[model samples]
Target: MQEHIRQLFSENIQTMIAAGESLSGPLENAAFVIVNNLVSGGKVICVGEGATSALASHFCQLLLDQFETERPCLPALALCNQNNSLQHSHQQDYLARQIKALGQSQDVLLVVSSSGSEPSLIKAVEAALTNDMKIIALTVDGSGELSGLLNQQDVELKVPAHRRARIFECYTFLLHTLCELIDMTLFPQQGDL
Candidate 1:
């Protein structure tokens, strides 16, 4: 059992390394766009489903609280963090409506999904487009509905993996990287060693 655990750790490390190499460019672009949006007085709105919902909330928390350094709070919101009184169908429409209501042209809609086919996420993306908000998608590789929805101006960070667990892991790492980049860009004194 110990050997198996060690192997799993090793494999995850390898995946992280590969993901860093392949995704660095896209991640940089995402960070740049996110920083521009925030500086322009726009908030980041996150939406995801299932396991990715946790990631969406985590990303917002990191931004609204702090990633590593002490700085002024950044504006962010998790679409999934809503009242439970709404019906299931209402909940599905809640995110779209929220984006349409709160989103601005300078704001960014960050969507996370391992399969890239969640209906609610798709709706959020469409609503963002309708509102003329920028989109940053984190999804697994391969052509899917979510991928198809992205336009040339949008940024899509596609993890080059198939397994859901691995994809989620990569997404978490990417989120952390984004937080770090945001912090570094905003507070240059807190540079990583």
Candidate 2:
């Protein structure tokens, strides 16, 4: 049991280290994308597949409540929150509907998913594009069709792992890193925090 647990820890650490270099440029770019939208008075719209939506909500909470700072709340919301999904998951267009209703051309859609293959997620990406919104997708390295759908304006923090658990773990870490970068960039007193 101990060795098994240690191996799991090792795998996660290794994945994060490998991702350090690969994801830096894209992640930094994503931070600027988000910062640009925010400073422009546009909000962030977060969505995801299955349980990943919880991560979306958590991110919104972090942004809205405060990400290790006392600065003003950043505008953000989760289109795929538990209640919204429960009320509308029956329709494939659920997320798209919300995006069309609330999304603005200046908004950034932060899409979180382990596998980027869900039909609904694909539809969500298409909807965001139609709205002229930028996208920041946090997904596994080889995440399928959803990645293909992203245009040059979009940023993808592709996790450098094949295992779903590892990818999800990386998402959490990456999200934290992203939040820190945004906070430090937007609020410069962070001093290498």
Candidate 3:
């Protein structure tokens, strides 16, 4: 049983390492964007579709509670929460409304999707653009409607894994690495205790 648990952790670590290799550059860049916006008084808004939405909310909680510096928590908000079912019904419009209501020019939107082609996810991307928020997209490399959303200026991070679960796992790895790096960089004196 212990060996099985160890093996499971080993595989997970391997996946995370591979994901880090695939995502390091964009992850670093995204971290810079997130930290910069946060330092400048802009909130970080993260959105994800389906299962990824849960991941998004989790990321928000982690960022709010664990990742910070002199900038404080920087207002991590999730769009698709249970309390906002009325807004969630409209999908894109809900995202647009939220962006308009909560986002500022300095804000950043972190979009997480496995396929990245889902209408609702695309709509959220468009909504973020409409609100002039910088976007950090985490998606598979091979496909997606979000290709149009990626540009020279935006921080677009891709994971090599194509499977839905694998893609989201990679996303989680990226977010965890981001949180760790941000925590250390932003609060260096704490060290790696």
Clashes of 2: 0
lDDT of 2 by residue, 84-173 (tens): 435554577778878989999999999997788977788888999999999999988778999999999999988889987888788888
lDDT of 3 by residue, 52-169 (tens): 8888888888878764333346478988733445655664566666777887889898888778787777877787788788998877777568867866657887777655655676
lDDT of each: 0.88, 0.87, 0.76
Q: What is the C-alpha RMSD of each candidate to the true structure, in Å?
A: 1.6, 2.1, 3.3
Question: In model 2, which range of ten residues has the least summed lDDT?
Answer: 81-90
* Per-residue error (Å), model 1, residue 168: 1.6
Which residue pairs collide in model 1, if any? none
Expressed as tens digits, the lDDT of each residue in 1-193 for candidate 1 is 9999999788788888888888999999999999999999999999888788899999999999998777789999998636678877677677888888899999999999878777778888999999889899998888379899988878999898777778888899899999999889988887463
TM-score of each: 0.93, 0.93, 0.82
lDDT of 3: 0.76
- Report backbone clashes per prediction: 0, 0, 0
Error of 2 at 184 (Å): 0.6
Overall local distance difference test of candidate 1: 0.88
Better of 2 and 3 by TM-score: 2
